[model samples]
Target chain A: AQSVTQLDSQVPVFEEAPVELRCNYSSSVSVYLFWYVQYPNQGLQLLLKYLSGSTLVKGINGFEAEFNKSQTSFHLRKPSVHISDTAEYFCAVTLSISSGSARQLTFGSGTQLTVLP
Target chain B: DVKVTQSSRYLVKRTGEKVFLECVQDMDHENMFWYRQDPGLGLRLIYFSYDVKMKEKGDIPEGYSVSREKKERFSLILESASTNQTSMYLCASSRGTSGAKRNEQFFGPGTRLTVL
Candidate 1:
């Protein structure tokens, strides 16, 4: 079984300031990580994913995250945020095992980012 | 671009009414999913179909059923609408991922259903 945890429920930051959204996961086997953003009344859009190799992953809209294996965390970071960056962000995990693998994605509760000017 | 389309933007139904939510994907993806979004809870999967007539129950499938008679379409059924069932329904699709293929799911605009 796999589960995702997003520590922060809401994050408020002034425009042009940096922000970090924390995520953690627990799984018995190797996993794939993903981040998604949802605007008002719209479906989620894929931000980025960490499949293998490089731990540091870059995503759209000047956002990036680092996958820390030791901590079991995949935190999303933005050097600076814009008013348009205010939205709900989610962290998801899928087990990538061979043979009888579950392709289903388990998602976090969500973090609401509010960028105020 | 991958496009996922839902049958309605909004719907209103009475209690005990049977409801159907239709979803179609144009990307020829092999897997389709139905999820419901609630405040602070994110999205909870109701059902998913990996191929035509193939279905799998997700984390929350108690109040819902699904149908996938064709490759490109998936339908979510609510046997009896209730107030708790009123939420934003989302449809998503992705190419079947196997052996390290990283396929991201594409989502629809969403259907907000109100059950009275």
Candidate 2:
């Protein structure tokens, strides 16, 4: 079984400031990591994912995340945030190469990022 | 662009009413999923379908059911609406192919259902 923990429930940042959202996971086997962002009244959109190789993975909207194996962490980072970046972010994990129903992702509670102008 | 769409953006219903939430995808993907999002709890999978007429129960499927009569459409059914079931329902679709892309789900705008 895999479980994800997004340490912060809410984070407020000034526009154009750098920010990082922390995420950690516990899994017995190799896992895939993902970050999703949901704007107000909208569904989730993939921000990025870490499947294999290269610990640092870049995503859309100038966002990036670093997967640390020893730390069991995958933290999302953005050099500079915009007001449009205000949204709820989620961290998810799934077993690598697993098939069928086992492919379901286990998601963290979530982190609401508020970008203050 | 891959597109996933839901039938409603918002819905209100009284308790005990049978509710239906519809979802459709234009990507012709073989996998469809239904999930509910709530404050603090994030998203919980209710059900999923990998093929037409084939369904699988997810982590939180106690009060929900699903139907996938066609490749591009999937439906979530609430047999008896309850206040606890009021939530933002999201639908997603993905390819059945191997590799990471298969798990990269494209989500709909979501349907906020309120059960009174």
Candidate 3:
């Protein structure tokens, strides 16, 4: 089974400031990592994912994430944030085929990102 | 673009009453999931169906049941609504691939259910 853990519960940053949301996962076998963003009163949208090859993955809305195998982390980063960036972010992981079942995903508690003007 | 649609945007139900949440996916995705989102809890899977009539229990499926009578539709049923069951429910659909690559899931706007 794969589990995801997001270190930060809330992150408040000023406009145009860079921010990083930390995520860690635990899985005995290989796993796929993903980041999702949810706006107020809305459903989740896929930001990016890490499957294979490149460790650095760029996503929509000027956001990016790096998959670090050794640390078992997939951290999301943004060089500049705007007021619209204020939202809740979640990190998720799913077991690879070599492990067991790949149907369901294990999600983190979530990190609330607030961009102050 | 794939579009996942939920039946209700907001619902108010009384305790002990039966509640049903409906979801439909336009794309012919093989997998559909129901999840609940609460404050600080993020999203917890309630149930999932890989195919019609094939259902699986997810992380939190205690007071919930699911039915998939058709390939494009999935339903989540709350046998007895409780205060704790009041939350935002989201529906998502995804296409299944054989490899380890994660498939993008299209989500509905979500239904906010309140148990009174």
Candidate 4:
């Protein structure tokens, strides 16, 4: 079994400032990492994913993440943020189901990103 | 564009009432999943189906059941809805892969179920 840990429960940042949400995971085998964002009342949408190659992974909304194998971390970052970027972010790891028949995603608690004006 | 649609955006039911949450995907995906999102718990998978008539239990499947009669539709069933079951229910689907590295999951808007 695998698990994800999102360190920050809430992060408040001013508009046009930079931010980073930390995430760590524990797994024995190789894993795929993902970041998803959720608005006030909507379902989650994929932000970015780190499957293989190029440790730096770029995603939508001017966001990016770096996968660190040794540290077991996939931290999401944004050079600058906007008011519209306020949302709940999640980090997830893919768990192989039934030995390659299907895959299940195990998600972290989540971090509420608040972009202040 | 991949689109996953749920039957309802909001649902309210009484205790002991049978509740059904329906989800449909237009992209002809091979796998569908049902999950519940809580305040602290990110998303707990209840059940998932790889193909028609095939279902697998996820992490949290105690009070939940699922049905996948057709390829495009998956329904989560609660035989007796309880207040504890009140949460945001999200449905997602992805292309089933045997040896692929990753399968991006497309999620629906979600149904906010309030069990009274």
TM agreement with the true structure for every prediction: 0.97, 0.97, 0.96, 0.97
DockQ for every model comes to 0.70, 0.76, 0.65, 0.65
What fraction of native interface contacts does model 2 preserve? 0.70
lDDT of 1 by residue, A1-117 (tens): 989999999999999999999999999888889999999988899999999999999999999999998899999999999999999999998887753336688899999999999
Cα lDDT over the full model 1: 0.92
Q: What's the TM-score, to 2 decimals, of chain B in model 3?
A: 0.95
- Model 2 segments beyond 4 Å from truth? none
- Per residue, candidate 3 scores C-alpha lDDT tens digits across A12-116 of 999999999999999998888899999998889999989889999999999999999999999999999999999999999887664224868888999999999
Error of 2 at A44 (Å): 0.8
Winner on DockQ (2 vs 3): 2
* lDDT for residue B113 in candidate 1, whole number 0-100: 99
Q: Which regions in candidate 3 have their CA more than 4 angstroms from the true location?
A: A98-100, B100-102
iRMS for all predictions? 1.7, 1.2, 1.8, 2.2
What is candidate 2's CAPRI-style docking category based on DockQ? Answer: medium
Residue clash pairs of candidate 4: none
Interface RMSD measured for model 3: 1.8
Question: Clash totals for all models, in order?
Answer: 0, 0, 0, 0
* Candidate 4 runs further than 4 Å off: A95-102, B99-102
